[model samples]
Target: MRRLPIRPFAVLATVGTLVLTGCGTETGDPGDRPSSAGADRTIRAHKVMQLTQTHEETGMTLLEGPVFDEDGRLLVVDVTAPEGKPKVMRVNVSDKTFRAVRTQGQAAYTSAQFSPYDGRLYLTDFAHGEIVSLAPDGSDPRTFFSGEIDGARMNPDDLAFDRKGNLYVSDSRGLREGEARGRVVRIGRDGRTVTVLAKNLAAPNGISFDEDYQGLWFSELTENRVSYLRLDGEGRVTSSHTAIRVDGGIAQTDSIAVDANGNLYQGLHGRPAMAVFNRNGERLATVELRGRTEGLESATNVAITPGGTKAYMTVSGPGGGFLYTFDALAKGIRQSNGG
Candidate 1:
């Protein structure tokens, strides 16, 4: 693995919320849909291409959270590096070029993505129980959010964005870790925290909002299921539903992405595989990884381009790393039966 300098925020102590934003409240009416981020428009689909291996031709372990930037660079979290030296890798899509985005000792990033509001990359620091925000250029990486360091309750993993600019961060902790049950939280812009959503879930790892902006969808890893809930007025979770059910979440249910067409794509844990759920919560299709090795090892994260044609996923190889692109180059994206 490549080595890089690390930048970690030194922890002082837990700073209790000055004022909590969203907490458990009365379920509001279903009319609480906020204004769309932008005028409704169609998301054009593009030809999907597989990302080539950056290290050797094969055999580099996966880097977490493979997401794109405005400059066409794919940023991935390299977690399996030497202890006290986890880092982010930036891969240039144009020529399969790559570089370390940031470095961190004592903190391994589990998941990451670029904020639509700010270009900063928000990545989960596994060791610190906090979020790391990196400058758009990969400089000035520092602590972004955390409930408690080494605190059993908050096990932040995967995250997503809503039109309101708030974030949906899920805790993958199961019941055994009583402090942290599998739940979803809505983090406001001002860093105000609130458990606006959630309950007893399996491994609630990945989450996403529907195109209609009326519902929140998440993946339950252990249960091998994809669950969802409709939001009422005031951004409160109203009705909980299941979008798709699978016997096994092969990829640890790493990440998820939804298209304007109402189709949901999920990255599995170990297997280099991606699952699909239609709007009606129907199992539409599953895309497996190509090439040698054990089935696209780490389909860690999934990303849908602005156009929606290509579905980009990460085949995170810790022993060896590579980026796998699943574009609709030959076959077109199938229709879904989801709501």
Candidate 2:
């Protein structure tokens, strides 16, 4: 049964409708001020499908790491199920129909990305501290890398790849807040060598390249900040700094996606919303979700489609988790070279 909210909230901004801008405060909270992009045409995100529900025994129906598959289905990771089993499910966006992927072993898959270069799927296995690759049809799983760097454990949480086939991974090291054990590393195209790009991070969660591939952006959960790194030809961080910081409204900044015009869409773990920012780190808009999807507690991650017209977000709330689709005015940067 489709569990609907007690009361439904009206759409704040309809799709393709232009709005007027309002003055905003320094904190960037929606209540204090309106976003510049808010005046522009916006789309009120509607719930597309309920992907997972909370399990009675474990209460862990958390969903994360959503990616569009080759056949246009949405692939997501469900962390908790009956008997403490973790697995991945493929969902048909058009009909909201889904089924678990057939796989072996303890399912601790956290994230999945389709490699445009080699036509395979890359996934992060948090349980074994390894990265695995699989066939397009979810078969022939094999370990890509499962080792440490500088004697620290490689507790990878999220990954992003560049056009040259290099993969960047954020190692959380399972550290708590304020503990700076998190780091970001890169796997060479050869897939054998692991190089540390930066260290002493605070719960680094999402890793993504900018529109032109000249800069990299990542989110720090504990610090509530997003940092940008400029890279030279050799894939080395030439300079870096904090681009944006959340003060009061949103709690934990999770995954991030970049649009074609360099606007960033960030997911919040403590707040049921997605925050948008310009290239200079200015808050452009906040798409808040509540009473839109059943049991939605927080927005965990976001992904913008190729042309940037549509967006997909993963939410983990009270009863279970859901995947949502909406019309996005900002066009997302199309990943190049088969990302």
Candidate with maximal lDDT: 2
lDDT per residue, candidate 2, 23-61, as tens digits? Answer: 011112123223464342223455677777655544345
lDDT of 2 at 106: 51
TM-score of 1: 0.73
lDDT of 2: 0.63
Tell me how far the alpha carbon of residue 166 in candidate 1 is from the true structure, in angstroms, after superposition: 0.8
Q: TM-scores of the models, in the given order?
A: 0.73, 0.82
- State which candidate has the highest TM-score: 2
Task: List residue ranges in candidate 1 displaced over 4 A.
Answer: 1-60, 83-86, 148-152, 175-180, 249-252, 317-319, 328-339
Stretch of 10 with least lDDT, candidate 1: 17-26
Q: List the residue pairs that clash in candidate 2.
A: 19-39, 24-33, 116-338, 297-317, 308-332
